[model samples]
Target: MDPHDRYTQNNFWQSSQAANAALTGCYAVLRYSGVYGGAATPLWEETASPNAYNYSNSDGWNSIAEGLQSSTTGGIISSRWANCYEGIGRCNYFLANVDRVISIDEATRTRMKGEAYFLRALFYFLLENYWGDVPLILDPPDPSTQSNLPRTSRQQIIEQILKDLDSATLVLPLKYGSSDLGRATKGAAMALKARVLLFEASPLFNTNNDKNKWKLAADAAKAVIDISSSAGYGLYPDYRSLFLPENENNKEVIFDVQFIYPQEGNSFDLICGQYNSNAPLLDLVLSYEMKNGLPITDPSSGYRPDSPYLNRDPRLYATIVYPGEVWVSGSNKVTVTSSWFPITGYAMQKLSVYNSATKPPVKASDIKDGQSYINYIVIRYADVLLMYAEAQNEFIGPDPSVYDAVNQIRARVGMPNVAPGLTQDSMRQVIRHERRIEFAGEGLYYNDIRRWKIAELVMNSPIYTWKHTLIETRRFNPNRDYWWPIPQTQLDLNHNLVQNPGY
Candidate 1:
């Protein structure tokens, strides 16, 4: 097993361990620069939305935030396209060789193959979400014969993804042992299918406004919920504690970009320091409702402008560090002060482990050495519930099941549910708001806003801080900005690749 040897007939498929490592190697692509590879994972997408602002020139995110991205200029634009293909290629290669290893048991081999299929589908899903249509390479094509390819329609690619995921669902197990914790499972495949169906059924892609599309999405999500009892999936009790390392494999997480410390891993807390990379903005802070289940604009909501942080939803405190929040650093309880004068006058607190006597020491040594071991949760039960609520509402109008699903989320965070009886349209708005607040710093808002057909409406306007201070004005060309342009390097390498319309 020479390290430099290429994956071939002579090596990598001879032993059960080699087969498993090769399969694990396919997942390594998730750690590529544009995906969940680095500390600024959330910023790569968050800055592109109105959710957060990269005040400093820390990364290429600020350019994306301003909507000044060009196919050639924006590094993330190119990185995302290339990295996803890299992951897909590994998956293809693994799938090609998985059956060669006869040393592994039938069940183990099937599950390994299932993981590869799910990962390949996931890579394609990421590509389609960012760049609407992309080349669909199902196998590792020979360079001499298939060096160039053309983009496939997003719909066609989605159908392929569903096919792969369905195959995956049959082979993958419901759960794995703790040692094999982060591997893709049957629920992971089903949850991802639900997500893909929901996105495909959104306004941005579902241009025909088909009611059946919404029903399809709703049914896919419900499929995951139906097996929740046996699958052992539910929301973690404390919202704040969910992101901590000790709770990495909690019941809430359906699937995650797996990571560990003192190995090939994460640097989330360090990058989101005082000069936070994915810093929460005032607009997001204002989006949280009062403790009494009312928007700030409502007279009975008891939201005070001057004391904005008081008596708010508990999640608001969990997710953001405002003027007076207490922050712990190596046994020292330091008050959060905005000394750098962040663009939005706020700093990100989510995904960071605060140092305290009760927890492991999260001091300077821990952060400097990249020892933060928090796994970035890609999907969780909370998101599944929200997706089910949204899709079900759109399909059959406001039903009791829809209310129960949403109320489950609200109850976990100790917030009041929607007023007893509401129309379908109003409940839609409620679900939308819940997603925004619930997933504030988690990098899902960008896709949520875009899919809901409101990116132009929210992004085009000037964004303000908590005190009505204008921070940034964004540009979103509804006709063109919905999908990022395919990278120029890709177009150069393959002439068949067409540039996105606006680019």
Candidate 2:
């Protein structure tokens, strides 16, 4: 609630609507323009990955991608740190004050508090991903006491996150009413915990390659799958249309940053602009396999460089605009190049509502208005399935459950299932590839490559566009690039702050 609004009603928290609004305010943090909201968001972190690149060096992600990120680097690093902590602060404030509201029913109060907890854990998770260790503040900070709080280890933070999610599951409802569609749920908490555990068990954190850790991660994911029906969670049928605004609250979505153009003054179209920013890179285009479930590089796959877009994975058409692809802008049917020229020769088609068959799709005008309502999905059922496949494959070689999970994802997009009797190592490769294509432009690529320890191999070479146009000779200093430096401004604010090594 705004301070002016609070001033008008001295006892705002005593009213149910006002109290609910405070809880809603905690959620408002997720819509921060720099994180999940506007053009450059957490997804912009993808630019640091080999999956995509920004043509402009001034682009925020380019600094981190090119190994120039420093304590003073004020793009994604500082924005995320500031915004995420802002979100955590909001959650803290809500939790500290919500108890004083007597008008809210006990059930609603518990659920609202649970949502605040989940949102807090999520903000911390984002912090840990970029900057390895961060100061863990549960309650609203007391300037008197927290003026010089030190950083907490990532492992301890993860433990606290799991505790929050566990507590959340005990009170959060299985689903929310339509009026409260985008609020967090029990399934979302579980799914997020599964993701954290999987990341915690990965090579980066689990340097010992402990099988027990993988089993723990697999079990956590399986817990989410086990509650699918009760939680109203399943795969949405149309892979291409899943991100559309009309399908915002589908069963596949566990948690999403809700956005509505004009109403919220936020646009997904503007987030991934025409060709100026966040364009699909050539390396990503080549990663998609053929329709027949064979890689383009395989001799028997029937891939021809001269006509590369033909007979490729169905997802490729749904994801990128190849040279000859038809693109609809307003009522005009024109090739993609006429409207947008991708620096990498491949324009982004994911999350964009355009088609040659229909002159004005329901969302056509939103793009032109810089107003799109597509909710940015954070955790979806597909991710759970893929995480389960990865964890289970690591825990025990290929098994029936592993195939069952992987096959469900393939069936949704009309792709053939993995052949039976594959070794654990082979299945690992398959699961990794499946995740790459299934979530191409969704911001998970950076997390995957980092956890799998493959960023250095892929990012150290010169990158070219589809037309062999050289874009950049990327650099990755493995010694210091894995973790971003603590912001210089932050260090100056708190003398207790410690910078990451090599900063």
Candidate 3:
């Protein structure tokens, strides 16, 4: 029996409304579990790094951190691959058919195209970051011709990603009105470009220590920094509030994945606050500098062993829930106990909505499962500043601009500026440390360590609890762990697919 009025690819793009809805479908992919779709998956990524520990292996990150992942590893390794390709497919379909809707205005059509280009580039960037060389599919899938595609060179994919980002910047607006707040913008495209260049220039990918690559990354970051004010981007005044639901789309956010409660929400608060899935490790807790911008190891740092949490960086109080700190849930003041966090003795406070200062504290019962609506920030101004500082320091010696960029971030948290006259080597150490502390629990350290070729050094060490009790030993084989293995299922489907080395 033939269907009477079903919409197919040929009939769907006949109107502007349908085309717009199709474009929205492309954005919906961002919410997928493997993507930034939910808070748990993104924040749980910290478990794969030294910043945090995962009590369970259901999420797949713990295995990766323990260097136990293989081609057959099923959780995140497989899902991330599938999700990125799904997003890429949606983007390809939208780009191929959106122009067919003649009712759309010329300017709107170009802008939508720019948004699609930006999204496609974003998906490919994720693929290249994790899988190294992924199959680059530009057009809508045609089964007969595309079923057995070979992996494209990562360098080639990155070149195309840059091209798409450049095209997006040329056509996309700097920012949008409130109605379209989460849509891709020129600033977002530029910021993503800078991140891509910085990763490409890192030691993992740039083994030769090419100064030119660092210069390129620095220049790209500077371009975004130069336009930041006009584009309405800056550091949000309060670091903790920046992740609160009410403060979403704030000035600090360059790009974020939108989530609305009761419709499409995430389990970030429940998992992080109530369940404590990703527990902050003792290694990361000790990384925060003293209030005066000195390491705890320093003789004059004023760090007392008995009062380890006091007189520390202000950001520490804003980001972590340690013993003795009161955690308010529905008017109930519960001081954290040693048994509160069984795995690491710490919980993250950055992305949860449980502020103790609210007139009526939000009830943990209210957001028990997936009722939270806080947007996951993909890129922010503070990150751009850090990127700029790191890239510039690598390109040239510790310059004044490098110092200024990093100092701005420190000053935001009321911490002292880094000392003057630091040599390039010293400045490198400072910037790397700042990144670990500044972006902790944000799911970035895993990549930072890998790109810096320090994952083996860090991950091979033993993980411990707050009391210095050994939890478990970790291993990182530099030959295999840096690039995740392509999923075993994908290889089974395609004869041309080859597994990553040592997997």
Candidate 4:
């Protein structure tokens, strides 16, 4: 008569309807609990969030930043894969069991199916980028159904993702209305699919030179633009406003995982997590082109690299709190001076609680500390705009509409117009640079560089800079580091599971 025993399938389909609802709860856990983790998830964990302008961690020209690990285990990056897949399994369980809810109508049933498909695609997208060739569990197995979960081909996995996304898009509502603004939408599915295609076609995955892959990516992104304009999505009035508490669930966001205040335990508001390490990297802070739509590299450009953080993109100021910005933190209005970066040279105070009334009092515990309710932008209109431009430029050799899309993003930030007749290489460079600025500290740059195929060189080579010392000798370990290794534990469980190349 034990209650836990009921969760098992003793003629599950024939009797237990409520158990299926419990399954929904399982999928929801994956939907909710999995916030940022692993190297892919920015930890900015090492830097001390300074309230005043002074470099206290005086290594002089050097201070140790956090990314080094224990020689025993791979540390966090190894553990995240297990956590990601447990949630994936839960989602897969939902996918396998949802059909049992015969009481629901076809429309309701299909919507649930669509949600499942989207969740799977999302999970795989994260896995592919991080782990590369994850064991693709399309449906939940009966405990004994499969003795081993084989590693799916990364290409086959991508193909499956595209299929899921396409199905989800057709069923998901374009508008969630006021009631469900942050949930995934048809536009969200389309944009993510487009991004996936772009990644697949890019040098990151498409080992073979297939021009059709680029065409597919372009077409998918264009579909989102063709449809999303009519939906209630436009650029947020100000790029700075995009991060404010007042801007949560703005028109721009197609989907975001909403976080809440005084949020206890592991949550999306984890930058302020233990050690508060996930600070903005300096490369990200300096990459923003001046508001004139020209890069800092341009000789005529006003921005000075030595004084790089000053007078640059408005987004740079809004997203990152640098050495000398007088910013009000919470109701206390604590002035942040230069001590922000003891080692890393920047502070990410952007996603912190901005509103006075709703601000989660900075808890003393790192897990719950300084976390805010600002919804994370899973897919935003600006990203969709950029995707359209990048895809179109690659597919059609720099279409004017592509210019318009890129320019609109610039215009939103008060940047000068994108030049007409810019070449593919120039525009591609511009987009890559803009992405570093626009999505800085949002955990996109690392992937953006990787997908652009520049990371093998950029991440591999070292430059001696004013702040970082260790990076001068660091090389991107393409063999074992580009994609994280499949968790050693997962590999042990599934004999058929193959590790990625090298790792």
Candidate number with greatest lDDT: 3
Residue-wise C-alpha lDDT for candidate 1, range 1-503, written one tens digit per residue: 55655755577589998888888878887763436767347544676777787766444666666777778764677777777888888898888888888898998888889999999999999999988888889887466544578889988999999999999999999989988988999999999999999998888888999989899989999999998889999999999889878878999999997777667666677655534666677788888888998888899889887788889998888777687666555666756556533556676667777522234324445465355668888999999999999999999988999999999999999998778789999999999999988887788999998999998888886777645678778888887878888877888888888888888
Candidate 4 global TM-score: 0.83
User: How far off is residue 87 in model 1, in Å?
Assistant: 0.7
Mark the regions of model 3 whose C-alpha exceeds 4 Å error after superposition. Answer: 1-4, 32-34, 327-333, 359-364
* Residue range 124-224, candidate 2, lDDT tens digits: 99899878888999878677777688999988898889899998989999988998988999999999999999998888778899999899899999999
lDDT of 1: 0.81
Each candidate's number of clashing pairs is 0, 1, 1, 12
TM-scores across all candidates? Answer: 0.94, 0.94, 0.97, 0.83
Encode model 3's per-residue lDDT on 1-503: one tens digit a residue: 43558988767888888988988888888873548855337888999999888887746888998999998988888888888898889889999988899999999999999999999999999999999998989999787877799999999999999999999999999989989989999999999999999999999999888999999999999999999889988999998899888899999999999988788888887767667878888999899889988889999999999989988998888888787777655666767776866777888877877565552234556665667778889999999999999999999989999999999999999999899999999999999999988898789999999999999999999999899999899999998899999998999888898888999
Please give the lDDT score at residue 42 for candidate 1. Answer: 58
lDDT of each: 0.81, 0.81, 0.88, 0.61
| Per-residue lDDT over 1-503 for candidate 4, one digit per residue giving the tens place of the 0 to 100 score | 53555655534544335544644544444323343432223333222111111123211101212112211244344545655666667667777776675666778667767776787788788888776776777667554755486767787888888899989999988876675554567888888998898888787777786778888888887787788667778888877677766778878887766555554122334453223355444555546777665678898888775776666778777666566555444554444444534434555555654222233324435345334456566678888888877777777777788888888888887888877788998888777766666676565666666676665565443332226543333345555545655656766767787766654
Model 4 lDDT, residue 341, Cα: 45
